[model samples]
Target chain A: MASEAENANQAPDEESIISDFFVPLARDWPGAYGLADDCATIAVAPGHELVIKTDPIRAGVHFFSDDSPADIAWKALAVNVSDLASKAARPVAYTLAISFPEQPSRSWLGDFTAGLSEAQEHFGCGLIGGDTDHATGPMSLAITVLGEVPIGKMVRRVTPSVGDRIFVSGTLGDAALGLRIRANMVDGKKPEQMTDHESLLVDRYLRPKPYLELRSALRAYATAAMDLSDGLGKDLGRMCRASGTGAAVYEPDIPLSDAFMAVAPESLEERRSLISSGDDYEVLCTVRADNVANFVALAASGGVVVTEIGIVRTEPGVTIIDKAGEAQDWAGRGYDHFS
Target chain B: MASEAENANQAPDEESIISDFFVPLARDWPGAYGLADDCATIAVAPGHELVIKTDPIRAGVHFFSDDSPADIAWKALAVNVSDLASKAARPVAYTLAISFPEQPSRSWLGDFTAGLSEAQEHFGCGLIGGDTDHATGPMSLAITVLGEVPIGKMVRRVTPSVGDRIFVSGTLGDAALGLRIRANMVDGKKPEQMTDHESLLVDRYLRPKPYLELRSALRAYATAAMDLSDGLGKDLGRMCRASGTGAAVYEPDIPLSDAFMAVAPESLEERRSLISSGDDYEVLCTVRADNVANFVALAASGGVVVTEIGIVRTEPGVTIIDKAGEAQDWAGRGYDHFS
Candidate 1:
């Protein structure tokens, strides 16, 4: 996909932008045709099935319009690949379609592509070809991730059985708290004036660590699985609804990072709001009671902590139990784009 | 993917929109996980390599902001699948990422998805999964098409040899002309006052037919190929650049439909302008000089008309020769996003 003209400093056009910036990002994938051909080709590894997912983000909606370009690029790719991780699939490649408000400066593109390259290397995937175009509206990105899983072994999101143990990876609420901080809507103290632990919460909102390393254990032990994008409460509710089942989660047992705890709301209603807020980007699953110990051990080996939070039930809705042994009411079910 | 609540008369939310509208479109693909899971899994057909391409279109850019929903849907899918067609690949599946400025009316979604469904059937590909979100900007679509070709057999864009016969499928300039008509930039007459042939050109601009029927012959006989999206002159220039060769296109031999002949500007300059305007969506290719007869015969059997418009040359740039045996200067190549 390279051209002699690409090295020269010139006004960017569609072709030159692709050859100069995108071509290097595609260098490792021989099938990418170096982003030159009409399409890219890849042979699925034998004994595997391809797992695919597409996710999109927009300025002012998913992230602030003025957010760092690098963080924007990372989140765009991370969210799509995170879906693959939740399916117990290992990343292989990705295609991105990006629309720009205007022609971004070369430095903006450089930082953006650098972030993309880093994420690709970190996730062990290569960049395939994608489409780039101008937009008279807000900048947006749509990424499609391609991954592989052992044949017939992808974990399902609708197979949790009654009495199965419900578990989640890492912690939640940090991202939600971070959002409040970014909007300057926190109850007290501004982001810059906050403590280190509070600042960590903001970072959590900007960059989520998808639990890819624990994918194997999840596939081997979980009865059902899904990524926690729409917060644990709503997403877990979705999994329950899909399986024609329900879940009883102990409110106090829901994991929260130290950073989230430092700035978190104390009132039961506010705590519930934070708990049901979106963008955790962690795994939520059910394991047979007998396999819970093994699953935890296996995940720990990969440096991901899995905490048992509740149990699946035959009842048909999600119920959260307070420390006082009473059901608590929440206003909304995480973030719903249309709602 | 369907839910009982979906049929209720209520304001749409993320889940309801998906259940009522997107689910039915996904029902045929078991691997789509009923659009319930975070990821979808598909085993590649044995011995086939996956050919992937992603293309996004936006309101006001790729189409009029007020274009019909069905046509927009068709164009979104068709453009991506057209890339597959250029690669001589047979499509298997696709994923879509859509962003909306506001929640669309059910009727809009109905027509949009209906158009998508029809395109899927027409292309023989299934909708696997997709992501939907709200945008504070214009409605936009990004589609990733996955097609298949026999292992290592996908056609390329950079193998045209010197002295190769350059052929182009179907007519050029109709889509470009259609754009002008739609924009009221047409000379002398309004669209409704135009003849059927002129209206036909407008239709061509709106709905491009990818030359899929000629794919087999293209792979078998053509030295190199690419779909003409950015007009013949510019795209041909790209192909030559990719192959490190040049081209000599005979102006008189360039294919033009009867519709174009009626409204086309007579001056060489204006004609060249029409030829270089974007959105032809035909195929431009170079066949070995020896394969010309057989290639034309095979394409005819497929009901595709290909004309020998030019020849490849050892020189390294495109030369459009006029009827008077002189090189004509043209300003600008086809569309470039940044430019």
Candidate 2:
């Protein structure tokens, strides 16, 4: 559900989402930013303080309605960890508010628990507590993760510096292509060609790594960082808005896995949509150009890859350049919550 | 629907909620204690930790399905605050997770937000951050409150000293009366009658006043304290179970309003039920008898009225005595989420 919601929420409906949801949240959570911005500014830990982020994913809307319960669980925890990963904070703990239907089978619950346990081990986040109730509606999951970074070290979407080199960890469109395979849109594909690659993409889409290791290093090395829950185009645009700057990325430089290129060679339009499709769950960051080599090396030592895809600019809007350095129209970048 | 759910959740056939609708949540929230506890413990501030409590108030379950949106909002925030109050923690911040059908009239949301704003101001708590999504089913309001207490000051239901005097703040059973009135069971009641004698009781039922004053006071003055949420009978039972002690409350001394007695004279059965009916939101505390007088004077100075209803016995379990100290029986006690 998260993979799907991670996409659906990015569609051009964030206006409604903001009006209906964020407006009320702003009204209720009156702080420095309110709901007008990405994260709420809260006073915590006396001198250090903290930043909080929350998002919800619904079944059918967020993931394939028939996604494995284990995968569902992984995505649920990973997505929230992803939120913390963006802030360059070490996740301290999290709370979940779950709504389930009556008489959920023990098996259903066990699979979900197993998935959560696996992620908890991987992420090192302690689940402090949350709510469980009987719901007669759709399956919905909302997890709120709390993390701590040094007060001054916390990286917000607003901190990117103009002329900063932008970077992303992991491949880009394989997850989006995975959905295409599941939908039977990729014909003439040998099962062997996709056996490992497609499955890897599918799994990544279902449970992309949260990039926790990258957070601390990013804060020290990168000027601003955010998790690519949405595709690069839309998410990068958001980064620009936060930093009050513009950006220019070469399309050919965007990271793409062999599996992704093989699956969607002829679908340039589809490829374009994938760039805005969301649910990537990798970290997209902007670092000073001088620090790019070290940034790449830090992730490399951890067996994770970081690629420089673009550069933040002092201009006030986003631009995408082709291989020939011709600016491409990037009208469609990421998903929005409301239409 | 919430009222129906409140009564019917324990019936084991509730999962019909999801199979009946197609919905989902994003799949990545980190956790070990995500789904199994009544509350989640979080390490918020270093020396001062926090207890996070989130409860969803569905129409028909937590409140009458016909309740006004304003009252519903009030009850939702009030209930979560009450949980912290039980632990004797100062209210700090809260996050609300709300899901309602799309296209809800702006006016409905306005009233709801107004109610929530009112509660926030009254409690000195700020809304931190949370989520809002669209749901096609019943209106569900999930509020998560984060409260900080000094490490040693945060009392749990599981800690009570033997020979401690059990005290309760304000009165009990009035919330139960409001439930009855809303159910149309208690009639011929006038608006003025509910003002003076029953005003405290009726208001206590609808808009429960948290014992925030009592919480800080208890840190220095109490051995163990908890809010009487479920009811006097059941809540006392829990305290006894948690503390590994016994308690005996004299029934004739149970606090009540003169109007409550005048309006429902034959409601002996009702009164007895209120003892166990839950949702009173008053404090049930245990203190060594030696310090009771000083605590009482402190409570009085804070404008909070507290009454001693029982004594913590060295034995295990609870026993209710009448005016003459004879044993008493109740049909049942309080609202249990699972039971």
Candidate 3:
């Protein structure tokens, strides 16, 4: 492969990109070795356990192939950090494996690295080590994020009890609605006709902010918790299944931004489908009734909104109640990668 | 995408595959949560530091698209473990991100997981977490391996001194020759005419054995070390560049398997080219001359052959010497992912 490519004489090799751009991003981390060595070494603090997650995003699958390289890089890192936050862990480092469809442009790489620098600083982590390669296909970004949590204190996805109040941080379904706008499939108006508030939904889809600030409150008050990437309905179903319980969620109480209500589907059926669409990246947890006030207060202090939408129950499946307190059949079950 | 696919009525969902097949592989690890949770938690030993490396291999680039799924899986794990071995670290866990070109068959998945089970047990590590996705492109397996070394003791790729004796483990060039056979590009004889010994070379190419047993000896006797994956000449050049030293390697002293000699190219020039063709996962290290005998003895006790191939020098580039004690110009550098 190298000989054939050399015969054609391509100008910069993978190594040069690592040295010129990626290495600068890694300079602050002593273990990164300026991207020279095969691996990086890191030590966890004495009282903490490492929380690890790997999530891969492909060009056409996770984001549009034409999305800005800077936004692409940010989404790649933020999604993995979202997993760490769900576990009530603080982000520390990440290893990125990126394969480009072709030799990336200098401008694109520059913007991408700039985005990565901003994210690493914002989340208090550094690039530890990674691998880069050339692909004859779409670009793929697979990130393995490492985080730290106090030993034996990380929250879990199971252990929710009957009567535990279900709460979610931040409004839901904006990303899903934003995805519709990006796909140009929004029902009524085209994206060019979108209002400023509607564009906020598009930004939410492009750049998800993992709720890291809610970690402390979740660890202190929640029994079962997870991130809302797979939509509130589907993800909550998973949490209930794991905890051996079910939930009764009020459809009118499912949080939505004013912008979402203004332009998104309005009828109960359409609204339920929109809200159940995923990529929220917010914390979804079940807290004991006694701890609800304290959890709400802590979340507010952290500058995050918390809303009670449901309560855990001994029933075997999720039940959605309309404004009239009548049960409605769900039209969708959230996003499944393969169907 | 999910709705369209669902309306089209695909055979299975991604979640079912995870719950049915992948969860079994992760059953023994409490941190894996039966592959249910979004993240895994692990506590490193107090005095140990984590060593991490991520390498991604694509179907056509790293292996043939038609290669046995089991062999592909083994190669995926072994290659990453080889990186850890080069750093003198003990393998502990790994996160896998696999993108499939199409939904794989049950038999294929079963064979692949069986190979993973074997490799994980052989290396004393467990699956922590990972991501799986469907791709419209070629299959890509990106793995991030986590290893442990005593704090402050992880081996690095630099710091070799003048007068250090360079050593390599196992025979070289067999895998490179095997690749040619696999590609049906062998100069004289077709692959169908290959002998059992020659076939062993192909197996070596398909599944590499990471030299983990030599970790203790390497930590004790070597000043600097790295794996010889991108051909000996190119990789040695990298090591020299990093350590600010040069090396004079004797061509005749470099070890080669009988299988490679039987079917590989003849003449000094042909042999040099063959030896320089990459994918030799053997360790290449520079040790103090005084410790050569002890290092060889330690390696022998561990049932590994260590060969003295060169010596580090004060000059700045690698010099390849023939049996006549004359330097020869290398026609090819190592494999570059992007040229």
- By DockQ, the best candidate is 1
Cα error, candidate 3, residue A278 (Å): 1.1
Candidate 3 CAPRI-style tier: medium
lDDT of 1: 0.85
- For candidate 2, lDDT tens digit of each residue in A33-90? 2222111223355555444555567775567646777788788878878877766777
lDDT of 3 by residue, A1-61 (tens): 5563353334457877788779988888898888788889888899998999999998888
Q: Residue A289 of model 2: what lDDT?
A: 83
Q: Considering DockQ, which of the candidate structures 2 and 3 is the better prediction for this target?
A: 3
lDDT of 2 by residue, B1-339 (tens): 546435432222112221121111111111112211111122356677555565667765677545666778788888888878767676776666676655344455555666777787777676555555566666677777767776545665656788888888876777877666656624556556454645555555668778777765677787776677667877787667755788888787777756567545476666788657877888888888899999898888878888988888886777788777678776236675544
Global lDDT for candidate 2? 0.66
| Poorest lDDT segment (10 consecutive residues) of candidate 3 chain B | B3-12
Write candidate 3's Cα lDDT for B96-154 as tens digits. 88998888766677677888888888888888778778888789999888899999888
Q: Which stretches of candidate 2 lie over 4 Å from their true place?
A: A1-51, A64-66, A179-194, A322-333, B1-47, B64-68, B183-205, B262-265, B323-326
Worst 10 residues of 3 chain A by lDDT: A2-11
Q: Give each candidate's interface RMSD in Å.
A: 1.0, 12.0, 1.0
B-chain TM-score, candidate 2 = 0.80
lDDT of 1 at A184: 80
Question: lDDT for each of the candidates?
Answer: 0.85, 0.66, 0.85
